[model samples]
Target: MTERNTDLEARTEAKPLPRVSPATDILEREDGFYVYMDIPGVRREDLKIDINENEMVVTGRAGQAASEKETFLEVQFGPGEYIRAVSLSDLVDREHIKASLKDGVLTIHLPRLEKASPRRIPVQSA
Candidate 1:
């Protein structure tokens, strides 16, 4: 049954959101995690970020040439979309996620939630 549930989850994630798999780096620290993605030619205005539960979806569109119906000497433009998705673990604090984009690179910071511990009680020695 657990295997079936895992399969179902995989299928659900594969249903939508065509992923481009942009170059990315993930840095893990004691308190949090940082994600850096390189999306060249992508503009800041066309970037999108969506977070749901443990899933984070990012999509960005690169800028296009101003001229229309113009022939390019070299066809170097690939798909304009830059898409990536990440599944976070339970420790991540979803509400405190922060993101920024600069120089065609996007960075996201995910803070981890503090673990609960048993309260210490003081006792007087008889």
Candidate 2:
């Protein structure tokens, strides 16, 4: 097993907001592609996904509440907007994309266009 190195300490030491530097994985299959990202402390309503001509953008924002009294902080994570942009190939079908978030994980499914997908053609003899 491989040990994972996360920047939790650095983030929490900086500020008191949710850090948004999520990691992502991209997988390509014969039919389509899948993109998985780890976005913690983000709700469904706080996420915004957009697909432009050749780019896919994911943006999230978490607001910070004002403290009522003096408080001692043990750790802090700067809270601000999280934005990530990815460029997609033309093979993807922009109209048939799907996204879902659960358990702090966001998954996006991009199906290849019918014209771009590989098809086995039958040979005919005249």
Candidate 3:
């Protein structure tokens, strides 16, 4: 019985934590694109954003605030990690990308590349 309990505890400790994807919204304009994500209970310091090649990844950890001395009578929500990955197109300018988080909402701006932006060509007379 002791060996069985030890094995179970080891397995549980080795298991990876589940990940949840935050709700996101992507919008496109003539000049740029906007991305909004809802990540409740995640602090700014716990969030990470990375861009490599044509992919952008967003990650955040929503940690529980209870201390070691605190005891819960009824447990509901627990700690969780949030992750989201976005694919970038050739038209987007990766150098000028920007992001901001406010009130649990993360907003990312991806501007269109200068060469890919629509422009009116002037007509030439012979």
Candidate 4:
């Protein structure tokens, strides 16, 4: 009988991770904008955000969090990557943008530029 190469067999059996888009919501306020995204199974260390040329990119790697000792019989959500991009407007102040992740929820704050904010002009009676 011929011996088989287990390393090569494992490599061929490996499947590529899936790519998914997380549910997102954007809310505009008088002072700025708030973005909320639902990205479950993603860890803080595996998340990345980048801003360039009026575009904001968000990416995260999500996978099963169970320990190796725990074996899954039926799998619904497998390993995957979450990606989303937003086109920023000129009114946004990119320098002051902030983001946070809590309980599988990502929140982003995009503050508007001072000059771009609305102001009330005083009415003078002539």
Top TM-score prediction, candidate number: 4
* CA lDDT of each prediction against the hidden true structure: 0.75, 0.74, 0.83, 0.82
Give a tens-digit lDDT track for model 4, residues 1-126. Answer: 012233323322476556789999999987799999999988999999999998999999887565644444555566678999988999999999999999999999999999987889999999
Every model's TM-score:
0.68, 0.70, 0.76, 0.79
Query: TM-score-based ranking, best first?
Result: 4, 3, 2, 1
Which of candidates 2 and 3 is the stronger one according to lDDT? 3
lDDT string for model 2 (1-126, tens) is: 011112443343465555356688999976699999877667899999988899999988655342434243432543466677889999889999999999868899999999986779999998
lDDT at residue 8 of model 2 (Cα atoms) = 40
Query: Pairing residues by index, what is the TM-score of model 3?
Result: 0.76
User: Quick one: best lDDT, which candidate?
Assistant: 3
The local lDDT score (0 to 100) that residue 47 gets in candidate 4 is: 96
lDDT by residue (tens digit), candidate 3, 13-96: 565444889899999976699999998889999999999999999999887565644445555555668999999999999889
Give one digit per residue, the lDDT tens place, for model 1 in 1-126: 556444444433555433467999999876699999998777788899998877999989765543543434444344357888999988788888999998888999998876622357899899
**Superposition TM-score, candidate 2 onto the true structure:** 0.70
Higher TM-score: candidate 2 or 3? 3
Query: Which residue runs does candidate 3 get wrong by more than 4 Å?
Result: 1-15, 67-76, 122-126
RMSD of each: 12.4, 7.6, 5.1, 5.7
